[model samples]
Target chain A: MGIYLPIAEISVNVFVLLAMGAAVGFLSGMFGVGGGFLITPLLIFYNIPPAIAVATGANQVIASSVSGVLSHMKRGTLDFKLGGVLLAGGIIGSTGGIYVFAFLRRLGQLDLFISLLYVVLLGTVGGLMLVESVNALRATRSGAAPVLKKSGQHNWIHRLPLKMRFRASKLFVSVIPVLGLGAGIGFLSSIMGVGGGFIMVPALIYLLKVPTNVVIGTSLFQIIFTSAYTTLVHATTNQTVDVVLAFLLMAGGVAGAQYGAKAGQRLRGEQLRALLALLVLAVAIRLAIDLFVTPPNLYSLSAADLN
Target chain B: MRAPNAFATAVVLSLLAATAPAKAQVPLTEGIQIGLSTDNVSITAGFSGADLTIFGSLENPDPLVARQGRYDVIVVLEGPPKPVVVRRKDRVLGVWVNLDSETFENVPVSYSVATTRPLQDITEPNSYKQLSLGASNLYMQPADAGDSPATIEEFTAALRSRKAATGLYSENVGGVQFLSQNLFRATVRLAPNVPVGTHKARAFLFKSGVFIKESSAQLEIRKSGFEQSIFRVAHNYSFLYGIFAISLAMLTGWLGRVIFRKD
Candidate 1:
């Protein structure tokens, strides 16, 4: 008996699906990333519609993050309190973002909007990271401090109403601020159909000034929860989750993440950031070009109506 | 901290930038091409079409290459709105077997399919649905009510009979047929005992055990003037677009930090 999938037009093999999962898993593991950025694009390249790709990527991310989160927990690096604060904000933001996501999709403006944003963000981020990391390397060689010396000054997040102390994460932040941050991150996650942990982690570290050690752990905790929620919602609503596909990708991702984490350990913090920045920039530029440039194949067909 | 050193470094950087050149592109003309035409021959429902040729750069152009082991193209067809069913058959020991397209479902219709080349592996197992008249069991239409224009049973029988005689379908109802070695036709023949109305058709092609191409068309099977309609309702739509725009901005912000933000 044949299993019927809602989306049509292409019938791919189980092995091919697994290989795609493996490729994305390797990249995610290597970078300590959620892999949605790359996975969505690759899926689109293979003719999977964007809506399905984003929803399905959320499913795969839950499993991909398992091994990475476990290792972080084992090292006693998690800051559950801080993660909870951000997650609260993110959840609200995601709810709002979903509304926007569905709206844009119906209007057929999703691709253009996504591409433009990627271009601006990627180019700026890549350029800045490359410059900073290279400068840090030069400074180190010259016997200068890698980071500028400064008073441990507080940021705006510290000044908001309803202050609460987070003992494990070493933070005494305002509840309102945490909620606001979570809301913003949540919105992005929902709209982009990505985990948004990469952004949330940095915000916690630099904006909130949480210590470096807790940054990854906190992000993973939040990611685990948010993605689980997203997966359940999309599965129940759109029936988009394909456990077979997700499992294949997860198997590859877990193995890749182990190696990636090890490799990450060997690189200097500045060097790693610089390399990652370059990669982000490249993808951003490619996406931007796609938006502005006329496509080679101008006419296409979608099999969605076949149902 | 020295002025001379800074000036020297700037010169070196400028020189490096000037020396870099754009990478070379691969030209498409360098690739070889091949021509293909339909090889006339029909395979019964139990068989597959077995004539196809490629007059291009064969890796080994020797005529003995046919027996020395080579690839032969097979054209297979199924149902209207053609779900592509074709594949490349690798010849071994003078017999061609479709290594592609491995699965078949449903059991209906009586069938027979004949081909010019000897099939490599041919068997009629309970699980295997034959490509010939036997397929009518599945393709056959359901019985209609009394005084109905056409009954499903009569439609399947008529199509089955036509297929047995000429390997060509005249009615516009749904059935699978192979026209030539390189070309296959999947048609939807309207049953003589059925009602009159518009219907849809589809076709698909396969290569190397995977579906490679497909096409679909909507045709009115009725004998009447065409009916068409288009409705557009415009309302407040920018809110969603605005949200997408903002979400993208946040992603960009996050990406920017990822690339440029200091750790």
Candidate 2:
């Protein structure tokens, strides 16, 4: 006699997950930025369980950044000294962020806070970055060098004592200012389940006046540290990190990064920034739709009692 | 034009049929009539006694409607049967007291208990049944009635084995209790391994060597979020992480070059 299996026993499409991963990977490559602004929300859209989705996204970031970091290092663009300083603050800030995240989870308000932050931060930044990049591209086509802005203009930050020279990034900024920036980025990274590269890279280039060459390296270093710590912490505390899942994503990410870097080489800085800005705007819009649109399923299982 | 209109109508009809809930007209058990007294004195069924008595009403005149099936009743002469087991050990005073005896054993007269069937068949409830033997001997025998002398042993054994085979994960949703002689709570705990679906539970009471009353309850178990967690992590995490890592890498590399550009 033949045994029959029930339909529910079969799994849904796995390719959906792989396709989403590839799409996010393509955007991340084109923009030269982390797409947590997009990836995390997409996971939720696909009905992935939130905690596992956040933890797994962190794992994927680790893979995605490795090749990008290597390419920047090879280009003599990586500022190791400044990267180290920003990283120290990022580590402390991320640790604090984890505590805040855990506290929010206990209060049962983490998802609300995360969604709100995504909408506000991603929307504003995406719009501003897009407009600025388009202007830069227009300016470049007219044969003018895009003038980089100075960060020490803020009198309050400039007035702080203990100024330090960042030789590789070619700036002399106050240690307090750098530390404050690092800490803010770290906290955001930890709480939002992101490495905060998209946020930090701009803050470094515009807020702190770190040379563009140093921004990616420093951000990558910080992300590598924060995400590794976040992954380990989530694993030990929530038992959320699954190594098998991490490895599979890493496999795809590493290859994707290589291809992305090659494509990035052919793009002018202004063109790349404009494209990235558009991508971020698109992701931000998609997330807004998710938040405001009517949900298909009104009744859902709570996280605490899923069974 | 007519064909296109017909196709659109067919599509609309199919969509409505697909979304509508299926009809739910399954009737409750059709053949059994079960009733229990509130005081737990007796359980009476319509179809168990040897001779049927049809009580007549002048106004209605159709007595068969009132007593169409056999009636089986469970009765306790005094109250519920109390089994007491006493354990005896010699004390330092050279007199042994039965420590294992239940409080019921203190009453000194032998009680002749008449039941519907053998002691084994009466043990229908799923919970552990405590049987006690005391100084006074207790005897149980089936009454002589029109009921057959116990060909239902096979059925009782099947039920007992099924009840005993339930695994540890099973939930005991129905309660078990000896409310009185004729009443027992037929308890079944829904098992964790049970799929999210509907299940049926049956409880039967026997007396005087015949099947008397059978009662049943339906249980519905629904799948919840915990099950989804296993699927999300087990299947979805890898792809999620893959995309996140790649985007982060690109962001860092591009921004690194721009920030580091020389004056």
- Highest-lDDT candidate: 2
Scoring each candidate complex against the real one, what DockQ results?
0.01, 0.02
Q: Give the alpha carbon lDDT tens digit for every residue of B188-252 in model 2.
A: 33222233334333333332234434443333333334334433443455445333434554454
lDDT of 2 by residue, A245-294 (tens): 44444444454555566577789877887777777777677766655655
Q: Rate the local accuracy (lDDT) of all candidates.
A: 0.49, 0.50
Lowest lDDT block of 10, candidate 2 chain A: A1-10
- In angstroms, how far off is A31's CA in candidate 1? 3.2
Q: Write the per-residue lDDT of candidate 1 for residues B1-263, one digit (tens) a residue.
A: 54456456545544654675232111111121233333222221122122222232222112232233332222222223221111223333432322322111221211222212223322223312332222333343222223244333433354445344433333222233333223333323222211223222333232222223333333332221111000000012223322332333234323333332222
Error of 2 at A279 (Å): 1.4
TM-score of each: 0.54, 0.54
Residue A214 Cα positional deviation in candidate 1, in Å, after optimal superposition: 0.4
Runs with alpha carbons beyond 4 Å of true place in candidate 2: A1-14, A141-155, A297-299, A303-307, B1-263
Second chain TM-score for model 2: 0.25
Model 2's alpha-carbon lDDT is 0.50
